[model samples]
Target: MASSGSAEVERDLTRDIRLEVSSSNRSSCQVCKEKIEKDSIRVAHPSRSSNVSIMKYVHPSCYLSSCVHFENSKCKSKCRLSKHEIGKHELRLTMALTSCEGKLKDQVFFHPPHASTLVRQLLDAAGGTEHTFDQLCVSLPQDAKAWARDALSGVDLTGRRAPTVEPEVKPRAPKKKRAAEDDEAESAAKKPRAKKAKASSEYFVEDGDPFCDGDQNDGDAELVD
Candidate 1:
């Protein structure tokens, strides 16, 4: 059982709308029509990396089979839904519900941030919305607490709450120096310094180019020799 404080924190942190409906539509997943919604569930998967889907709810049965991180023969239950979302999809799976006056507003899906926008668009094509973040985080799912525990690797859920922000403090302005003295200092600093050393005035005596055999000597000195 979660404490009242942690419970509220968990709710706020994971607030999202979740729904369970019995659709006689019997529609198999459009991605794979092999299974029917009557016996299967439909869910959203992010089309690309790092972008979450909004209102793109996935089906329960479909999720178990088609998850990218589908494991064989170990854990095959609906309880592992959050695990699939966190582990398989770089996107998160949040069950945030919207509300007006702290009451039911609507139900929607939240994909992980890493998933592409197109995934959400695809979901919207079927069933989705464009609700804002504040509109979200109202009705979070219970799954988030457990999944956060497992995925977050056991960070304490105790005492987690909405952060109380403090008022901002502005910095003080810099002091102005005395004008006459500052000007004198500035002018003195800007004066150029004397040269440290002059380059050597000596120049090397030239020899005939040795690159060509035609002129192998220094200006025909070898020819004279």
Candidate 2:
């Protein structure tokens, strides 16, 4: 029975976690809250909720130190600070809140650096003495107690929260509208030019007309001759 239980735990760990080279730099680390550059090694934790699966990523060092229960996760909704989607598979930290009866209430997600600032705010609101970082870590599940302690060893809880960056979305003209404008331009270019009308007082001088090349006086002389 003991061996069976151990094997089950190992299987769970393998199914939930993995390490791979990042294919792109679009994802940020949940631990250090920095971009995991392309082609770099990163840890992935698959989290599931309401039938949706989100892949959370982090740096290897951050994963080693963080509590297993508080493992880095992906943002499930729009970020409060950035007012934008943190994007699928982006790394984020999860803070779970429970009721007085120890019932799970809600969970809030934030960028790794932002999580630190929030902890500071919570402490300040509670008179700064009610809770400490160590105390908070102690409250978490002890699945990775030693690692959790190491994770917070040199972390700065008072450090400034890094700003959330909004993704750039360039507006594109509608295809129908663009096509209509192009058609209008093409039609205008293809229109035939209107021929100019001659004035009522004007007449064409034929090639051999007597007055075609000479003054009126010369034409009169030629007529007399």
In lDDT terms, which candidate is top?
A: 2
lDDT of 1 by residue, 1-225 (tens): 879999886754343223234355554442345544553334533221245433333454333223222111221222222323222222243332223354422222222332223233333333434332212222334433343323223234456431122335789655565667788899999999788898889755556554434534365454443
Cα deviation of 201 in candidate 2 (Å)? 99
| Highest TM-score scorer | 2
Clashing pairs in 2: none
Segments in model 2 whose C-alpha atoms lie over 4 Å from true places: 1-14, 69-225
**Predicted candidate 2 versus true structure: per-residue lDDT over 73-192, tens digit per residue:** 333465444445555444444543333475533344544544455444344433435355565566444543433333334355354332233346799867998899999999999999
In angstroms, give how far residue 133 of model 1 lies from its true place.
Answer: 26
Q: Which ten residues in a row have the lowest lDDT in candidate 1?
A: 68-77
Q: Rate the local accuracy (lDDT) of all candidates.
A: 0.36, 0.55
210 Cα displacement, candidate 1 (Å) = 39
